[model samples]
Target: MAHRTRPLNLAVPALAVLLLALVLAPLAAVGWRGAGLSLGPADWSAVRFSVTQALLSSLFSTLLAIPVARALARRRFPGRGLLITLMGAPFLLPAVVAVLGLLAIFGRSGLLNSALQALSLPPISIYGLHGVVLAHIFLNLPLATRMILQGWLAIPAERIRLAQSLGFGPAETFRHLEAPMLREVLPGVALVIMVVCLTSFAVVITLGGGPKATTIELAIYQAVRFEFDLGRAAALAGVQVAVGAVAALAAWTFARPAGFGAGLDRGLPLSAPGGWRRGADSVALLAATLFLTLPLIAVFLRGLPGLADLPASVLPAASRSVLVALTSAALTTGIALTLALAAASRPRPLIEAAATLPLATSGLVLGTGLFLLIQPFTTPMTLALPITILVNCALSLPYLYRILLPETRALHADYGRLADSLSLTGWPRLRWLVLPRLARPLGFGAGVAAALSMGDLGVIALFAGESQATLPLVVAQLTGAYRMEAAASAALILVTLSFALFWACDAGGRRAAA
Candidate 1:
């Protein structure tokens, strides 16, 4: 057996316990407060709406992504790589920024409405269930496409060559090769998309427009903040957790490592770019391009004019956001690394579940619980920044853990015996063997955490006073106050900062790896 040092042995459960306390304490508080309350009919309405929208969003995003992924995979065009990179932007963009962008294109007096007016058609309202689903598709379609594209690209070139030699057409090729990959990939994609849509807070609240389109997450917010109904909020949070857990487990079951094979340093050729294939690919690419690019373009154009007239609160909020992001990044990276290392060494199911607990706990629930826990001791506002930092760290851990676990396991698998034989342990082992090997994932995970924390509005919305708002919450407040132009400007700044943080950290990772 490998020698276990006291510090290394103690760190695992310590970190695990810390994570459990951060997540579950708030949940327990909420449950204890609302123990006797049953869910009302309106709560049930929110539940139905939440599930229905999430299902529709996941279904449409996954279904639409297939042809788009196929087009991008088979037919290389001018700027194809750039388009692929831009597909990730929606994910990084603050949800408020994306909402602003979407509204700029789809809003009543926006470009689409103007076009409809010119064409003698009635302007359609960007509200209700369909609007919410559309927003979700906008956000998640790229995610689905990327997952599917990775799967498509993973089909070995030799297999493609075999199919070509056998005179297989597109139909035959898809039937034998692509169809199976899709079958393997789609469930995970759909389930992940569903999990995302299930949370459905920022986008749903923005586009949902009224009670008619409320999601459970949105309802939880309303119950706590608007109605001061802790019982209802607690009940709704419980529902969110229950649904989220099932979806998360299903997603985990279907999840496979996206096998993105290497060989891109050389010019590799593909087998599916002929006559009708060319035309179909062009249409798919163009449609996706127009759909994704136009909103961002609108945001840039509109926000440009508003930048000079931006409110006084924006800069302070931006600063606060940066602080929270950095703190959350450090905390998330540390905790995720610690927990991942422990899990890698031991492979305990309990540790793994604790690592993923945040996936089942929403920001609203955490915030509510934290608020309740702290309210009696001191004002929630007094500890707002600390609480936000902790909540953001907790929320980001699951993703960081995902990124770190595989790398940690690979490190252990490759170096455990070698390191043990050398009598290398503790700081020496970590510095010489683990740290250098882990720099890339650590940097990437930290980048993701920072960017996500920068954009997170949910828990902060629950805890922040007027003066304590983060950039996303500030943007929401601006929008609610009907300052659309100023809101756009703030959102653009938020989006820029989020992407910049991600790029810097990600670039640092790449440089360190190199």
Candidate 2:
């Protein structure tokens, strides 16, 4: 399924040069000390701690999601679409926002604690390993559920109908039909969770009390941002990259193409269960929804009044955020599309990997790395707008790829042969055969990139000054200044903008996909 009519050209190489310039900002800043560092016992201990936590979190998140997903997939109910949308909402949130929401639900003065005090029970701590795991689960459970639900959706309905027609009992049907689908999806779920948890920074930092809960990304952050120990940060980052590369590659093996199931080949009708199975499923669904949503509700309640008194600075901050998101979205999409186009039918894993390299390191690590790399050269604040935009673009490539690759593959699959046969290659082919076909995915990716960059707090963290601050950066500043109301107001605004951007882009994509 490869197109060979046209020879490779300069798009990716040229864009890669630009991408490399931006992506390598940190490595260039920290280059002198790169070779001087080595992984020692302390680094190994941090790695051990991070790996264990990620494994436990991944296992727990995936296992817990199974029942939730199974319940959603197997049962019928009112408001199911709403439930599904809520489940998918976490994927759209910034990790910091989700962490905050989790804190509101699970922290000392949280709902759980209020319930405990009514019974006069001892208060539980919401810091350290337990809290980190809880936050990750809260954010990722829905993701795992969606992935598994996709698997459930993949089960050809005809197969299920055949079993029913053969008078197979419910238990027998599940064993023969459902079990295989779950097994096929399990590794992908685990691997994705492991990769995500490995890169945990915001959650670990917010929830981590001290050494006992330390993750490697947090270690890298402290080493650079707090301690200014470029040497230690480099060592830990290197270790993280090495370990993460292995895990990512393993996950890549299990990673199948997205959009596996269409509502074609239908047979069995999907519906809800009854009796004890129904009650148990209903209860699980209710608790999962509550745990997933209550913290956001708390944030809403806390911020409702505060929205009126939002700092005069917030509007300007918001203005800056939108401008930055626009620039970044354009840049990210341009870079992503160029790479995807240039790489349309070539062997370019290195180029692909380089474009996506930003995801391996946490934003804290990236910010610090870029800070060190760019400091001897220039103040990041001098180019704060562009630098933050680039970082967000780089960080969001994997998501962009989630859209681009599929559309590209499908376009190539359907018409590439004919186009090549007719010798309609290069821009002509791209303009007609490719772009029109991929409009939906590219637009969708752009929308996600825009929405995600809108809520970013990472690059701005390194570059923030009074003269320049995005809304999330402003929110962080408000939190640092102990203006809880202002921070809440900022968070609310940030969420709204984030949601709107995602919705618009996704809507456009859907229209295009249609």
List the candidate 2 regions with Cα displacement exceeding 4 Å: 1-8, 17-32, 36-45, 256-264, 267-273, 345-351, 354-359, 412-437, 477-483, 508-514
What lDDT does the true structure give each of the candidates?
0.85, 0.75
State the lDDT at 419 in candidate 2.
Answer: 83
TM-score (all chains, Cα) for each model: 0.93, 0.86
Point out the worst 10-residue segment of candidate 1 by lDDT: 260-269
**lDDT per residue, candidate 1, 1-514, as tens digits?**
2456776677777778888998999998888877778987778888999999999999999999998999988876789899899788777778888888888998976899999999999999888898888889999999999988988878777667778899988889888878887888999999999999998688877888565788888988888778978778877787788888899899989988534344334323457657988888888888998988888888888888999988999999999999999899998898888888878866787688788888887887888888778878897887888889998898898999999999999888998879888888878888887778998999889999999999998888877887888999999888777788898899889888998899888888778777
The per-residue C-alpha lDDT of model 1 at residue 126 equals 85
Expressed as tens digits, the lDDT of each residue in 1-514 for candidate 2 is 1354324454456667766666566655444456676766766778988998888888899999988888988876799989998887877776666766765667776778888989999988888888888888987899999998888777767676777788776577678877877767888888888988898766776777366778887777667657777788776766677677788888778867333354457635434557887888888899899888787877777777888777888999899999988788888887777677656666587667766776555555566667676677886678777778767887887678656865666677778779868888767887877767887787778888888888776657656777788887777667546566566767788888888887887788678657
Q: Residue 79's C-alpha lDDT in candidate 2?
A: 92
Candidate topping TM-score: 1
Clash list (residue pairs), candidate 1: none
